[model samples]
Target: MSATPDATSAAPDGGFTTVIGPRRSLLAIDLAELWRYRDLVLLLTRRDIVTVYAQTVLGPLWVVLQPLITTFTFALVFGKAAGLAPPGMPGPLFYMSGLVPWFFFSSQVTKTSRTLTGGAHVMTKVYFPRLVMPISTTLSNGFTFLVQLAALAVMVAGYVLAGGLAWSPGPQLLGLPLLVLLMGALGLGTGILISAATTKYRDLSFLVGFGVQLLMYASPVILPLSRLQKFPTLLRVFELNPMTAVIEAFRAMLFGGAVPWGGLTYSAAVTAVMLLVGVMTFNKVERSFADIV
Candidate 1:
């Protein structure tokens, strides 16, 4: 009865035709699409975890060793030399409370920032949600974070049992998850932005490692936000860095009795904005990455 052909019919050009259909937004992170590529994501993650430490004598111990060494160095320099409060907290505890998470955040940011360049092979040859590449990088680094966390916990418990540190849970304890999410999101967003840039400017990958080290100093990693507050103008500038609030939130949740809701709120807002910008920029550039990279 109808002159119109079937929607699935081939066109005159000998190609399958796409009929008028409901439009789907391309910018969205389609979880189902990611799920379809779940096997690839898992495989990549496994590969990263296995190969990352390969040929190294210490292997997984490097995870513990890295933070342990940094904690001691910071404790001796910043904690002691600067007359900062190691407080009732032992030196290792004080330093590790900041070190482990900071390492996780920085490592994730650095690795994911090079995701595009590093995965050029998979990108050109495969059809999957591009995000799966970076997500796998993030997930792979999670084991390193877990090991550092376990090491920190053991040290903390030993310090408490030895009467070298005070042990008291606080209302701020509830904000620990929020702090972790805030840091991780900040890393993910920053990494995504840098990754997209690196596809076009390969130098960006090298810059990211040094850039992260500079960011650690800019943050309250080795000091406190309160210390910076002594210089009101300086504190204003420092606050603009998202990690200022994030690291401060870490201290509040660990040592203080309550969360700094204001700081946490600011961190959440900044991370959200960064994530949106990163995703939009990444989507815009991704179409060109295969050709360029």
Candidate 2:
């Protein structure tokens, strides 16, 4: 008689044996799987974009209004009252430039940080890669951010036409892509970290909202790094925020000014480290998510 086949043996239909082993520390993110779910990502992203503007009469106009209003307020408070120099450019242009990226960064963080909870039903019921949730959130906000950025460009043109602005191209312009990457990396990394933590701790949601407001004040959205001259120590601390480099780099690129190479490099380094840590932690916790979350 033929020897009995073992449990590990392959089935006649071509199915392979399954084995349970220790979970790997780093999940080998399957790009192919993500590609297969690209439609889902796009669908979810579209949902977010639509829901964000659904009830508002102005709809997507809110994107343009948000930064426009904030920039105007900052221009009045910081530029007019504080007598800030406006980053060697016109006051409105300077304030709006920083507001654009600052809003993008903050919005990305807030939106993505809640991805897991916001889509908990989908997460618990679905088998797709969990990373897709936060990523889709980022992409959704990114689309709106681009729209707002176009409005910023039109405003810049208006400033130029009125002789209130002067601009030139600089090498820093080439660094805008890198700046955007760092911003996304920083937001994604922190968002995942917070989202995972918040799954177990409910209070984190409130903290995330409060923290974002404080973070905006901490960043140089309204005030330029140059204005921090009197507080050299504070300036140094701000430089360490990672976003400091991103906002400053954005200003430099748009205004044709000197690049903040030191700060930018620091941001890149921090982003790399944080992303690695956040991904690892996220993956490790992902398995038990359905159970706990």
Candidate 3:
């Protein structure tokens, strides 16, 4: 981030110059500095969303198709053969709820993980806030998530017309924005943490692809949180996953149920800690990224 001169520190020529340099404070972020670079953030975010499918045949259609395909696959494997979905709830609706949020989170971690290593050329040439890289990626993913979420909303509406099945909008829907913030925060925190590490440990860049897949099961994506009850030990482990509550709350908001206040409270705390630690570590490493990456 760049440092601003005080109001009285103008040069004798009466010109104010902002100095671009390394971040000095380990735990404190310069929100004003970050705000000044908001244009760059918006640019990078646009690039992130556009470049992903720029040359692909389907382009943005894949955004809708990917979730639908995965939802049905899970519906077949987990809901039908395994008999996992709660009775009377449509399998597509059940899994789509989880996939919408989970996809946002996983994409954040995957793309932001390469902020330094994959973007070393630009990083070396530029003098913007290092934090800008990850924030743009998170924002771009959030935009894509909104597209997917609209599709999910249509599915929920369809299911409601067919049987209602407690799938109607209510005041609970208001909490959705909070859940989106939590989801983005978790992804941003974890993403930057990995992005910083990947600067020195190049292997993590490759491992992140496999790691997110494994982490999906560790959360309640394919399997509902309730089914884990038989394995009390495993259930305890899954309970600690912050996304469980976020995803569950997301479903409850659409399907009508009580909020998972306990899990969401725990999730907010964990996300706060992870984001703080992630930002501090990222800031501490900013000066060395060019050389190390």
Candidate 4:
């Protein structure tokens, strides 16, 4: 008489398995699970960076070139034509300073907003934390941001050496890392919030691009806050935009401008609330994303 085969060992797949289920807690974020899946996060991030420029002639150079071209275009339209550059700061330098942080924030927001729909295939097949998708996209784009920032630093250094610009970083520059973190938090929070919504309402995905474009104008991107002083109401409204403080802090850090402590504090508070709301919404929606996506 032959022995019966073990039921559990019948299948050939042998690796460890993770059984995912519904989260019990309403505000559960599962940071521990995310940490446990750090390898997967790194893998996904590498894939995002590689696939973004795969088979392209320029490859990663586009990371630096895209911002360079944008800064030049802004210098022409807003600087030469509209004369919107902040006094004493060169147009290209001023624009590049703002564009570096804005590019990172905008790219992360756009990519994270599509995480659920974009990764539906993997989500259906695997049992990893869904939060990894957006987190990895944010991490991958962060690498691109560093590349662009390095190029900006080089240009800024050249301008200083040529006497076209001056350098006077203060104690506020030490807070640059915190400022970057705030920028990422704002983008991730907003993106994940939108991502959860878009899983049900597909049209919301189409609006992300337009919304981000409008947001850029609402912030102090092309024109400095100083230029809008005549319009106190408009400036106050702009201050309400979280990005406005981040951009202002970026400029202040790099160019010896006045740091807006009040605005930054407001932005930080708003960012914390947004992130909490995003995590809750994402947790509630992630359970059914595979079915609808």
Candidate 5:
């Protein structure tokens, strides 16, 4: 007697079996699925960019103006009043160099951390990878980073032509792209972890702003690593912060300084671990984010 075919059996039209069940593997990233949705990612990213400056008079110019204004303020407050500028480095250059990456990191972390909570309405209406929200936010911020970086390059060129600053391209510059990638990964990792946690505890969203501000001071955005050397313990703390290495390495690439390879290697290791943990945590919590968020 012929037995009835099971519902889970392969389709007659093709040799494909469709299984409808919960994901068996807990930590899988599903890169294939994300790739299938690339067009959506781009669309979301473009939307974020446009919506940010949609009605503003200055529009995209705000990207350049924001960093430019911050650089000047830091130069005045830190360089002129506090006397915190790095020796032999132009105060604006010094601050801009550090601020460029710091802003990118902080903005990504802040925006991406709110993805699930902010996009809740859309998430409820449709079905897609929740991870896409944070990722698209990161990409949108990356475009802003590029705009700011270009502004920085123009400023650097002006300084070079002014006969005060010495600009030399070095081998360390080759690491710039890698450094940006590491910074993004670090931000994404931390942001996703916080976002997952915030699904249950809403207070985390409130603290994120104050925490980011505190974290900036903890890193070497306004101050240089050299100044922190007198306080060995504090210097060690800064070294432990992954951003210290990234900022220092970025400055070294632009100007001339010793590349802290050991610190950078440590930061890279930490970033990798954070990313893994963040992804796993995000995946686990995302299953229930719609209900909680």
Candidate 6:
């Protein structure tokens, strides 16, 4: 790949240009800079999708099948045995509704967490908005989320026809776009925060998986917020998780439950703070990341 100049600086003989440099403000993240690199973002997004399943036997079909398998495992382990599945809904449907969004969010966190480290070779060699890597990762994950959701839709239709579930659409369904953006922002924020940390502390990379699992439990992924009411303190803590609203709102919209406006509103504010902090931290650290990583 050729070096992409971020901006022009000054002239010595033929005008010198710096390919990669920090922005003027530590908190400054230029959205227009990202937009200017739209072609690179698309290229990276396509590469990530192709590279993920390049040598796999199942290929993209894994996107559909993997979630189905995981949903069954969750339905059995959490739904049947533990009896945490919500009342009056198909167990798989309940679990699938939560897992679909959770999968997308988790991928953004996991993959984007590696932006500085995983792509050390590329980062050291060339220059583009470092933000592009995580953005592409988030976009790449959109494909998987859509494929899995389509599979879940088929399942929901089956259950509806079999008299196991009912279709009661709610106005909250119109908020799907906002819900996805919130999920992506939260995930991308959490991810890059960890990525910045891992630059100096490589051990953080090893613990990303464990941290995400703990976070999953903190959210209302396997268990509904309603189920936590008995423990008011615990319920309060869980409600504080930004993902709690993302997953619960999604399950509520998809499965005819009531949307949690109170929790969702709180989560939106939390996401704004987190995303702002993440961008600031990334900008501050990335100027020296190539030297460290």
Task: Report how far residue 140 has shifted in candidate 3, in Å.
Answer: 0.5
Candidate 6 weakest ten by summed lDDT? 1-10
Error of 5 at 111 (Å): 0.7
- Candidate 3, residues 1-293, lDDT tens digits: the string is 23565644644434545544554678868788889889999999998889989989999999999999999999998888987765557788888988999999899889888787777899898777788889998899999999999999899888778876565567998989988999999989988888888887888988998988888898877777777778998888888888888888888787777788999999999899889888987887777878775
Between 1 and 3, whose TM-score is larger? 3
Q: What's model 2's lDDT at 131?
A: 86
Q: TM-scores, in order shown?
A: 0.87, 0.90, 0.92, 0.91, 0.93, 0.90
- Better by lDDT, candidate 4 or 1: 4
lDDT of 1 at 113: 89
Runs of candidate 1 exceeding 4 Å displacement: 1-26, 85-88
Clashes of 1: 0
Predicted candidate 1 versus true structure: per-residue lDDT over 35-89, tens digit per residue: 8678988998899988978999999788899999998888888777878865445
lDDT of each: 0.78, 0.79, 0.85, 0.86, 0.86, 0.84
**Ordering by lDDT:** 4, 5, 3, 6, 2, 1
Residues 1-293 of candidate 6 have per-residue lDDT tens digits of 11236434433334454334433687767687688899999999999999999989999998888778988899889888987877777778887888889889888889899999998899999878899998999899987888888898899899889987768878878888789899888888889988999998999998998888788888877788778889999987887778998898998787667888888898888888878888888887888888887
Clashes found in each candidate (C-alpha, N, C closer than 3 A): 0, 0, 0, 0, 0, 0
lDDT of 4 by residue, 123-156 (tens): 8998677899999998998888889889999999
**Model 5 Cα lDDT, one tens digit per residue, 1-293:** 11224533534524334443566465777686687678899999999999999999999999999989999998999899987777878889888988999999999788988977888899888877788888898899899999999999999999999987888868888888999999999999989888888888899999987898789888888888888878999988888788999999999987867888998999899889888888888888888777775
Compared with the true structure, the alpha-carbon lDDT of candidate 3 equals 0.85
Residue 180 of model 1: what lDDT? 79
Please give, for residues 11-71, the per-residue lDDT of candidate 2 as tens digits.
4434444333566657467676677679988998998888988888999888899889988
Stretches of model 3 off by over 4 angstroms after superposition:
1-23, 164-166
Best-first order by TM-score = 5, 3, 4, 6, 2, 1
Clashing pairs in 2: none
- Which parts of model 5 are misplaced by more than 4 Å? 1-18
Instruction: Tell me the lDDT of candidate 2.
Output: 0.79
Per-residue lDDT value at 221 in model 1: 73
